[model samples]
Target: MMKMWRVGLDEAGRGPCLGPLVVGLCAVPINDVALLVEAGVKDSKDLSIKKRRELVDWYKQQMDSREWKYVVNICSPQRIDAALSKDGLNILEVDLFAECLNSLSQQLSENVSILADACDVNPQRFTDRIIARIRNWPWQQSEMDSIHKADSIDPVVGMSSIFAKVTRDEMIEEISQQVGFSVGSGYPSDPNTQKILGRLVTSPLPHSELRWSWATIKNKWMEKYETPPPIRNESINVQKTLF
Candidate 1:
C-alpha cells in the first residue's frame, strides 16, 4: 500500500555567524518531482546565485499552477541561542525537525513520503524523532524517511534548499552592513570571521551576536593577530557558494 504523495524537506544557513537557520519542508506531487529535476534543480550549494534565483521563479510559477505545499521556517540566531541555552544544539535541531513535521502532518496526503537531508551527526536519531512526532497521525510508514543528502538526491528538497539558502544569505548580508564588517561566511573557519572575533575578544565589545561557545571562535580569539585583516585565504570561496 503505497501513498500517492511525496514530500521533500531540506534546510539552509546552518553555519552562519549571523542570521537564521532555515528548515524547509516541501511536498512535490510525485508526477511533478521529475519535472523539477529536469528544470535544473540540484543541491542549493551546487548552483550559482543567478541560476538558483531563476530556478526559483520558474518553480514558483509551476507551483502556483499545480498548487504545491511547502513550509519554510527561519530559526533566527537568537532562537538558536535560546534553544542552545535550554537544550544543546543536537536536541534543539531535533526539536526543530519535529516542529516542521508537525506542520506537514496536518496537510499530509495518503500516499506521502518525506525526504529530509541529514543535519545532525546521527541521521537515524533525527528520523526517529520526526517519526515519533507524527506517530499519532495514523499515516502509513511511507509517510516519512530522512535521507543523508535529500536535497541533492531529491529534486523537490533541492528546490527548497535553494530557496532557504538564498533567503538566509540575503538576511546575513544585511546584518553584515549594520555591523560594519566583512563578516566572513558566518562560519567560524574563515580568517575574516576570526578577525572580527579576535578584535571582539581583545576589545570585548559586548558580543551577543558571536557564538562564543564554538571552538573556532573561542580558539582563534585566543591567538595574537599580526595584521589588520588577518591574512585572508584566497582559496576560501564563502562568497561564491553562499551569497
Candidate 2:
C-alpha cells in the first residue's frame, strides 16, 4: 500500500486586535494518527498554557527525527492590515492557509490529505476557497477536508492548533518584554490590551505593532478626537452686519 500523509492546518490570533496572526501546519504518517492521540494531543484551547507548551516542546523533539513535519507562517500586523485592506479577512486567511498547505505538501512524496478548521460560516465554502487558492500548487492531487471545528475532533488539526497557539503566545510575550508591560493576550476583551491601545492610539502615529485599521483602534481614536459640531459664528453677528 502507498504511504499516506495527513496534513492539518490551523491558526491563532485571528480575533485579536493586537499581535501577529499565525497559521500552523503539521503532517504525519496516516498510520501514526492513533499514536498522536495516545500522546495526549487535543485542541489547544482545551489545554492549559503549561500543557500546550509541553506539547510544543515534545513535537519539536519528534520533528528532529523526521517523525513529523510542520510549518508556521506569521502574518504581522502590517501584512495583515495590507491584506485586509485589499481583501477581507476570509480571503487573507485562505491565502495563508493555502501557503502553509503548499509548504507542507512539498515534504511528502505520497498521497496526502489536508484538513483545516473552517473559519467561514459555511464549511463547504471555506473548503472550496482554500482549494481554489491551492489549485495551482503542487499538491493539487491531494485530498482536502474542512469542518466547522476540526480542531476539537481531528487530532492532527488539534496538534497544529497547539503549535499555532504556543507560537503566538511566545511572540506576544516577547512583545510585552520589549514594551516593558503586559499586553494581556492581545485581545480586545483584555483590559491590559485595551490599556496599551488607549496609550498608543493617542500618538500622532501609533506604533507599527498596532493594527491601526482595526475597529478597536479606529473607535478609540474617534472617541478621543471626534470633532464637535462647529460653533455657530454668533460672535461675527453675520445677520446684523453685511460689511
Judging by lDDT against the true structure, name the best candidate: 2
Model 1 residue 122 CA deviation in Å: 3.7
User: What does candidate 2's lDDT look like per residue over 1-243, in tens digits?
Assistant: 667888888999998888888888888888888877988999999999999999888877887565688888888877777776677788878888887865655556347888899988888888888878774544535688889789999999999999889989998999888878888898888988988876666545556666766878778777777832111111110010000
What's the CA error at residue 180 for candidate 2, in Å? 1.2
Residue-level lDDT for 242 in candidate 2 = 7
10 residues in a row with least lDDT, candidate 1: 234-243
RMSD of each: 7.7, 12.9
Predicted candidate 1 versus true structure: per-residue lDDT over 13-93, tens digit per residue: 666654577776667778777888788989999999899889877867876677677666667555666665566776656
Q: Give candidate 2's TM-score.
A: 0.87
Off by over 4 Å in 1: 1-3, 140-142, 198-205, 220-243
TM-score of each: 0.77, 0.87
